[model samples]
Target: MALIRFVLQSVVEILVLPVTILSYIGIWDPLYKRFFPYLMVKITSAINDKLGKIKKELFDKLPDFASSSGLSILEVGCGSGANFQYYPWGCKVICTDPNPNFERFLKKSIAQNEHVKIARFIVASGEDLSQVASGSVDAVVCTLVLCTVQDIDMVVKEALRVLRPGGAFFFIEHVVADKTTWLHFFQHVIQPAWRYFGDGCCVTRDTWKNLEKANFSELNLKHIIAPFKWSLISCHIIGYGIK
Candidate 1:
């Protein structure tokens, strides 16, 4: 019975492999973006609510040293600008993404937030944010973006270069799981196909390790599972750090 089940699964994966590859190459990303932005807002709003609760639970005792007044912030890979709503009032956020399609959405989203009127939207790649002056930003935010960038090291270096000394780098991302043997095996097997379908999102990169190797300080790590799953294979991770 197990052999038959395994064979069926393999066959299904093989059949979907080509579609996945093409999707990762961004063949369907436009279609996805059209419908995805609305759905993403709803879904991420819920996720952010939960994250708020979890953050309070985890860091309530820690000193809230981050500035509460207007501060210059940059968000790398701010897809559709969904996170703009989560920023504190009086923050001057600059949202940047390589995708030109995101510009319209980012502008609209920022317009809705009175406190975020100082926000700016830029169409730029993470690798070349050097166009923004160094040591000018008070904080840098990246969410679910590092996995898709062509060069993670360069992105981190650029983030470090732009951040002021003692400023924080905030991030929330899903990363490769490191738990059970079966989970690891499945991740290894599906990674190629997953990346092809998910726009270069690698499910096996240990982002925390990568950030540490980049020498970012005050690392804080946490893991959270997505609200839904199929056969324990679909889980998520969240990591944050400071510089």
Candidate 2:
């Protein structure tokens, strides 16, 4: 039984290797955007609703220096501009995504919101946000994005650079399971295949460790497991830090 299982797993991994490689190179991004953008938007909106209260709570914790009015805010990987509705009023919002195809969705979404009418769109990656001034932004927000970036460290560095002194970096991301040995086993076993079809998202990344290494002076951590599931796959950590 063990031998058969091992053989099947190896075959699945091998079959998925090419797709994984292509995803890393961004081949599937356009295809997915073109064919499945509506589905993607629905899923993202649902998840955002599920996490809305938590987002509001985190926002309330921001330092006084972080302004909801006339303050500059940059959101990396701002897919379809799903976050615009959640942004506080009177803020200057800049939404960026490496995929230019997301612009249409962003425009449509922003059109419905008077508060976000002034929101600017940038075609850039998290690793290279040169258009944004260093130390000018009061807050940097990223949600469900770290797992998909190719260079996580570079993105973190960029976040730190753009944020003003005492600024906050807020993120809510699904991370690898910290408990459940069996789930960890499954994550390892299926990661290669998952990467192939899921836009290079890793189910198990030490995201908090990355934040710590980024050297934020004050770190606030919150771990929330999905309701009714102890499985690591559904667990998420939401927190922020000050520079």
Candidate 3:
């Protein structure tokens, strides 16, 4: 079973490795940018179908201040704007990502989800969001992002910095499996290749532990298995933290 899993993973990664290399080198940006987002949309759509209930539970907690015109949300690593459909109606969202390639796909998502207003789409990573002012947004969101960020602590800090007092930071991430599990062993074995070919995603990150120490005024976190049969990335953590 382990050998079979390794073989399948290698095949998939081999298909994506060239695109990853070319994308970083700035060759065929248009082609790769389009292809990558298309792949992500399909993957996220499947995941969303399973996590609909969990997402509804978390997003419903986004505070609605009577003084403000509408909720302002900043989504870090907002790839293809997958969470746009989950935002409250009429709320304004500021999307930021290091990969500028996602901008076109984001516009398409915004058009489809017309009720959610897109304030702007900036090409910035989660670690350095200096472009956004401190205490500017009512909420900060990151879905499937922490696994790939260069510095998880810095990203969490930046999310807190951008959020207004009492604002929330929402997240959904697949994390390291339980230490005693066979899945944990698999995750460690394949982590290096996964990071190289899967856009810096680390399969065995202790994301929940990091979030616990992130200094959130309040945190409501839960671990769940996503609806992917025997999938390597099925173990997940979904929750929100109040700043």
Candidate 4:
């Protein structure tokens, strides 16, 4: 029974992986980005509570504000505000994404999490945060977004540019596996197709290393394995750095 089940599962994964890659990137990402809000709610429904805890951990690291409204959090690639419910009540949020299609999804999330205010929705890329002023925001939050940005260095610089002194950059992203292994080779082999299908997400990017180069005053991060089903994308890093 075990052998049969393993065979069946392997076949299913083989079929689903290819099609998922092609459709995700080539078919329609803008339209799919809109659907991602609902898809994510369903996909992460079982783990939402756990994810909330992780997000809260990062948010808590930010310095408490002296102002009435609390800290201004700039969420780069805020994709439908998936982390909105995790924020403290009354904290100000500035959600930004290059794709305008996600605006409708953001509205729904904002309505659901009314306590945390959605102060602004900027249609901007992570590399070019021209709409946001330098050293303005109290904290910057980015999750699962570093993989797909056009320029990781520019994006990190943009995040740093908007952060006030002593503020933190909270990030949670899947990174490249270790160099001395077959998994690392696998990641490199499928990366081109994966990048196309995953909307420019390079499964092999060493995002943690790039974060270190961003010149944060206090840098700290570590890796954690994801659930088994995402084995290929299982190497994840969740941590924050004070600027």
TM value for model 3: 0.85
Tens digits of per-residue lDDT, candidate 2, 69-162, equal 4567889988887777777666677888887777888888778766754457898989999999999888899988898888888998999999
Between candidates 2 and 4, name the one with more favorable TM-score: 2
Ranking by lDDT: 3, 4, 2, 1
User: Regarding TM-score, does 3 or 4 come out ahead?
Assistant: 3
lDDT score of model 2?
0.77
lDDT of 2 at 42: 85
Once all C-alphas are superposed, what RMSD does model 3 give against the true structure?
Answer: 3.8
Give the Cα error of residue 98 in candidate 2, in Å: 0.8
Q: Which of the numbered candidates is closest to the native, going by highest lDDT?
A: 3
The collision pairs in model 4 are: none
lDDT of 4 by residue, 1-243 (tens): 446545654665575676566565776565566665576555445445445666677666654631344678899998777788777777788899987877887898899998887889999999999999998888899888999998989998998899888778888898888988666766766664566456567888899889888889988797887654645777889988778
lDDT (CA) per prediction: 0.67, 0.77, 0.84, 0.78
Against the true structure, what is each candidate's TM-score? 0.75, 0.85, 0.85, 0.80
* lDDT per residue (tens digit) for residues 14-42 in model 3: 77677667767877465644567777778
